[model samples]
Target: MNPDNAATMVAIEIQQPGGPDALIPAERPVPSPGKGEVLVEVAAAGVNRPDVLQRRGFYPPPPGASDLPGLEVAGEVVAAGEGATHLIGERVCALVAGGGYAQYAVAPAGTCLPVPESLSMAEAAALPETVFTVWHNLFERGAAVEGEWALIHGGTSGIGTTAIALCRLFGVKAAVTCGSDDKCAAALAQGAAAAINYRTQDFVAEVQRLTGGRGVEVVLDMVGGDYLPRNVQCLAEDGRHVSIATQRGVTAELNIMDVMRRRLHLTGSTLRPRSTAFKTALAEEIRREVWPFVESGQLRPVMDRTFPLREAAAAHARMEAGDHVGKIVLTV
Candidate 1:
């Protein structure tokens, strides 16, 4: 690596909120790791829906975070702050608040997971954001256990595919919704118990049919708005509804009496704004529960495409196009 590149790195930044064109390349000073953090010379970064939202001006980085748009990265740790020296020279993948778009990004030591030799830099880069979100929302908050059934929306998306893969590994059955038949097929190929074409079919009715009218035990919803009430209809008695994103719209109207009558549970979470202590705890839990699958090569991200770091705009465009089947990544 060039010594000057260690001091200055090429990063993609949003010049102004609009479209993919808003993301522009620029030279930025390499960020230094703080106490309990490690500085990664990033090899690859994952592109997520949040990155697209940030580019469109809908989502903003949390306070004290880099304005650059990236959530997860995989690379080699070259420098470490206090209490993090042990991680130096280790290949790690991490979930970050922001700044993952740069060549060098600082990550909390606790959030960095060791990258096994079985996975490539691009594949490792794709794990953290989706894995953390699914583990927390599906298993932890939703209380989905083995042998239960889960309904996941956006089946071809990074989160949906991760959820499907985890459900398959953990013995939970997953039924996913997609916009097209091809996507539905893709979801089925990814180990989903069933796939619903939401664009042409009524998912609530389909879920009922698939479960023999008993409905699903859990619903992992990404499309909120009117989908909330519809999602509730797709759940069984004492079912859990976990919302992770509001892709459709935020506000929704629901029948409270119905919720009460069915003994239903509703919950949601956003990972970026959470405290470092909370994220660290989550990281540890995943390291224990899910890392084994990753290390053993039994689990891997379903990759869609990879773009050069300088062409982040093209990556954003691909995500927005909604034609991709899995994770979109940026390689440095």
Candidate 2:
């Protein structure tokens, strides 16, 4: 494929590992697609917790990944690499390891999915990371069955809200825990069966109460540390608990008797370091199981706020403030 006219694109670069102020707008060379990849002219990109962690130097990009921070994007494919010629000119959303915080980015051909025309680029931008994550951890790993009760640890986070929506769409009962009453109300409005105020009430008690004292079938946990033990307690017999992040702390201890008695499955995964083939398989699973809901509007992207591409520092600041209820995005 031929290159675009411009040699470089406006992108966000982390000057150093520190605060959000480290995110500076700068010009960088537009990247070319490799074999089995597509070069996309990005219209918008999703801001996620991993991006913030990377900016703060806690989470470094995997080997050979872009240094730029964005993990997901919505854009038009400008060119395709060998054996991926079908992607050119397609408007799609993709889960990228990095390099999304720019005017142009390259994504694995297998990771790209068609965006529904009804949604804005901003909404589509918000899909890849959250959708793939929820699908992987919540359904694929956690085995959240339809008509079963599930507890989500962070109700208003990008991953949490998407989990709630997908659970509701798939007929699983969803209960979430958030820091504020407003967030609880927001979760309820998004089709969550229940929302617990984690700041005040005990989530274990709330989950028990909401599930009629029977406990839930699955728990989608992002807050690790002490929550790990409590997550196991929140589940029913033969239950599954999946961890996608360790927001509170990394280490925790659990009761040996709890697992033996309940037959619980404790598992966790980090998405960024996985192989392209693994992500490609996940993309296919999402296409068959989740994309219909997205395209039909049964499930919707919950976008809380958006900032200009240049004001990414401000966006990160807002995210750190902990007030927004849904996905934060940057419009290019």
Candidate 3:
């Protein structure tokens, strides 16, 4: 539980960007907390899609960010830099720009949320990236409100499940698209109002049918490429389309006339590469608005599995295999 004088730690680094095997174990000097940061003795770190992309050499860490591939971690704060001393002894889950695939990592004090007694280290580790993304894209940028319906792709993913849970909590209905019937059922069980097996059904038509031809108020899309035009078809007039990731492909051709006529809004964001001040503000807003549900045990990240930190390659392989139904974590 102590990090004092721990000069080195084990980290999973990308030996080369290619495949799961690219992630390799290495010895690294334990990082120090910079001003307004805390050194966390990591208990668990969340494995995310971005980590996979990073491993494949498609995504790289932002400048000044750690090259190691991980975005979130849950741990005990063992040391703190000048302005962050107050967090030195707290249990926290933080969203980091990088360097989470290690036994210890430095995190911005502002991005760290207090881990409540109700949450396990693994579950806490799973929250930051997905929760922040969903909250920002679905509610803030998309402007989804109570009683509205949202269409989310990747129903079984960390982002999808977190979006469903948050939608349920906030009185917004979520209809999700999954690759399989089983994943669809899982999404329904996780509180999605409807789940479409995209592999078997036409999601655009199904969405139209589900909403009785009115269409949903928002579309939370991660699958880009061809899905973007179809997603636009699934939206109601003035509906918002928020793109968080481009899993399918990056390019898409949308009907500008349709967009203009329907008054649909298309917007997307990448959470990394954003300024520290912006993330800090976002963290504060999430703490004030969303932490209550977490503190009350009403919100928790859906966990699929946990792997040992050294088995990070296997973890990435599991994610790429696409059968996991929820968040995956690397236990430290």
Model 2 C-alpha RMSD to native: 1.1
| lDDT (10s digit) by residue, model 2, range 20-90 | 89999999988889899999899999999999999999999999999999999999999888978898988
TM-score (C-alpha) between model 1 and the true structure: 0.98
Off by over 4 Å in 1: 1-5
Ordered by TM-score, highest first, the candidates read 3, 1, 2
- In angstroms, give how far residue 309 of model 3 lies from its true place: 0.2
Q: Residue 50 deviation, candidate 3, in Å?
A: 0.4
- For candidate 2, the clash count comes to 0
lDDT of 3 by residue, 221-241 (tens): 898999999999999999999
lDDT of 1 by residue, 201-255 (tens): 9999999998999999999999999999999999999999999999889999999
Give the count of colliding residue pairs in each prediction: 0, 0, 0
TM-score of each: 0.98, 0.98, 0.99
User: RMSD, each candidate, Å?
Assistant: 1.2, 1.1, 1.1
